[model samples]
Target: MRKIVTVADDADLAHLVDLIDMLPGPDTRSFWGEGSNSIGSKVGHRLREILSGRGDSSDVDYLAIYVLKYLGRGNRHIPEDRITANLRGASGLPAAGHAWVEDATRTAFTLVTRYSLPVWNGAHRTRGSAWLQG
Candidate 1:
């Protein structure tokens, strides 16, 4: 039997993109096709387009697939609250140059690994669920 997974809400999707925005250097270029100088602005623009229903679904799915392929779980489940708390904690820290970036990257990695992966995997298995509708 297939399990149905609800699509992540807009706020959640934004947070996921924010996490991606925090990625450093090569990872940023590799995933987002841009440098870290103004990745946030570019991603923000894409997010706005997406929220407005003017973005490409394939673009969104590409990010989702990347997270699922890299961070998916086998049978273990990680709570979203934990991921949120970690992200919050990471953001709360004082700006320490590259250290903060590293912290954010680590937190983002964990969030994708523990939270986003399952959602993506579930949706993929079902060929998408009702929550996927924009």
Candidate 2:
């Protein structure tokens, strides 16, 4: 079985939800829930382009890095050297790979979303996260 890496702690998710709600514009954030749209993939793809020098690094903020590094598999993807090569292959700088690899290495490991799923009959999971915070 594979392990998911989302913030299963209620307190943590609560804090995160509060923080995500504070973002200024609709296009800048991905607040996900029933009606909340989870456009994180767009941000990821855009960031990959900017990281490859294809676009600007405007949204490369601390919070983004924090989530990507700790909660998700950000640092584990694309090596420094491969960035340029991958950029070349991508032909316009999309996410280097659908799955992240051990930076600079051709070998790719499985890269799951790390997002927590509803568990324990939804009691434990729902209690830990609040979609209403946003």
Instruction: For residue 9, give model 2's deviation from the true position in Å.
Output: 3.4
- Residues 1-134 of candidate 2: C-alpha lDDT, one tens digit per residue: 43222223223333443333322233533231122323344434444443444432222232244344423434443232333233323553434432322221111111111122232236355543565566
For every model shown, the clashing-pair count is 0, 2
Report lDDT (Cα) of residue 88, candidate 2: 29
Task: Give the TM-scores of the predictions, in the order they appear.
Answer: 0.30, 0.21
- Write down the lDDT of every candidate, Cα atoms only: 0.43, 0.33
Off by over 4 Å in 2: 5-8, 26-64, 67-134
**Candidate 1 lDDT, tens digit per residue, 1-134?**
43222224444445656654444323334333444443334444545555565555443544444433332222122222323333334553444323433444454455444444566677556545567878
True-vs-predicted CA distance for residue 115, candidate 1, Å = 16
After best superposition, candidate 2 residue 12: deviation in angstroms?
Answer: 1.3
